[model samples]
Target: MQFQPIYYDGELLLPKIELHMASCQAIGIVTDVKRKQLLMDQLVDHSNYYLFQAQQAEYMRLTVEELITFLNKITERNERVTSLMDYFALKEERKVKIKDLSPSKRMYVTLMRVFFAHQPTLVLEEPYFYLEEQDRRQLKRILEDLSKEKQILILTSNLEDAMISCDVIYRLNEFGFYPLDIRDSEEDKQEVLEQDQANITIQKISTKRNEKVILFNPPEIDYIESIEGSILVHVGGENYDCALTLTELEHRLLNFGFFRCHRSYIVNLQKVREIITWTKNSYSLRLNTDQDAVVPLSRSKLQELKALLNI
Candidate 1:
């Protein structure tokens, strides 16, 4: 059925609105505050019955608070009386409420619509554009969770982001939108294997101080801390005190995951718990032990560190 036109800023309705209007028997248009009132005024004076009928289906444009209230009302109605449940079960679900949904919640709602409503065609526009990395990962998981339930059209400009999550990608180029690439997610397993191989070159430098002291495996070394011109190697369980300068340690462990982050300290590439800015010219490294190491990060080193960490 035709859904209410939900407009953001009144500039345009999402492209899916037109498709829904063509397929559904009824239509509802939801627009923002001033635009909704303007549309309501136009509909009141218009004699076009078809337009008015469509406008009548326009459920009130709900604010975030109002949407919460409406959801509460639905739950209350469902719990209150058996007749209300029966009626709701018999009728086509007519309610459409849009609010500022968290990334996880939005994915959950999309999956619910795909499964319960049997919506054959679904369109999402940069749904995770504003989400943080962790939240984006959760949303990606939800998309994978619902992959078999419906046909989805996702519009995004980030090819790498899309490739990580989507099976079939249609890229928009100067020529026009086309299926630029189709990837079997199954093949992604092989890509991960290649990534593991890429990391295989990180050599393991044995720490020697009167005896052979091997730090934990490459991944277990969170980062190295340099203090008083000496580099301290941080591993999974303990810190290895080394007698090498930050530069010397960087030279020796460069093939491994050691990077020079500051003048006082060169850090183990893997042991970096967090990077903290003490000031514009200075920064400190927070280790896995929760101790803060003040280190001077040059502009060049900051950029290099970002690239190394993929941040």
Candidate 2:
């Protein structure tokens, strides 16, 4: 006895192909080198004229190397090219290994989706996966920078990083997409106010007379020194001890006139009375209060701060 085989003929297959092509168009698919070559081969196959026509009508094939070269030519900075190259490397590595791509590449692809997709809204899940601490910070900066260009929707479980990076945050509970928090300049101001209130409470508790406070409001603070995990906020004539870590203080006071000039210090921008070029790679910040502090500036941030201050 012969067995009959289940089959999908041209009628059924055409609809499936159309649906797949539409899905691919919606999401902006990126094919690896092998898949791209296979697509091209199928497009040129005389036996599958329908597939060939579909490929020609729906998509274009380009090598990752060619795409990198094109991007390098149009991009202005060496850093952008470096980032693109890193992404290309990871893409190739993933093809060879058939495993998870590097976090940097994943970030790059997500960014590309945002750039190329027609939709104004995009969502990213677990974006920080496989990234180093420094890379994660860089990714946050990149995302923050990109937000100026487009509205992004990110779904992340990392609360601290999300707080640092997002303007508005939401949580998924039984109620669905609850607005958990909104952090903007106002939040930053409230944080500063709460910090000041806490400081007042501490002073009242300790009765420290020489403890400092801000007499006149400044545009920005350059750096605050960290002593034994506590931040020393230098204002008019004295140092005010605050029970905040240097990073936390920087985040809280950044909108109020503080900038992270070093890992251990955050400075007031308006209080930067003068900047002494300490060396080719470093500088010293002189405050309006006649106090000087040395802070290490990375080459990139040094240029950025100079442009920001117009110094």
Highest-scoring model, lDDT: 1
lDDT of each: 0.43, 0.42
Per residue, candidate 2 scores C-alpha lDDT tens digits across 1-311 of: 01122124422211111111211111111222332233334333233221111111110233344444444454433336446546433344323221243435444433443333333333444445445555555566555555554444443444333444454544432222234322212112223334443433221111122553333233423345654465565554455665657655555555675676655567777766766542354354556654434343444456667887777
Q: Roughly what TM-score does model 2 have, to 2 decimal places?
A: 0.30
Q: Worst ten-residue run, lDDT, model 2?
A: 13-22
Question: Model 1: per-residue lDDT, tens digit, 1-311?
Answer: 22244346654332222222222211122223343343333333222211211111112354333433344465453233233323223112224343344544434333222222234444444445455555455555555544555444444444433443555544333222234322211211222111222534545545655476764554556556543344567655456766545554465566677776644445665555667552354344555544433233454478778998888
What TM-score does candidate 1 get on C-alpha atoms?
Answer: 0.29
- Determine the backbone clash count of candidate 1: 17
Off by over 4 Å in 1: 1-118, 182-311
Q: Could you tell me the lDDT of residue 16 within candidate 1?
A: 24
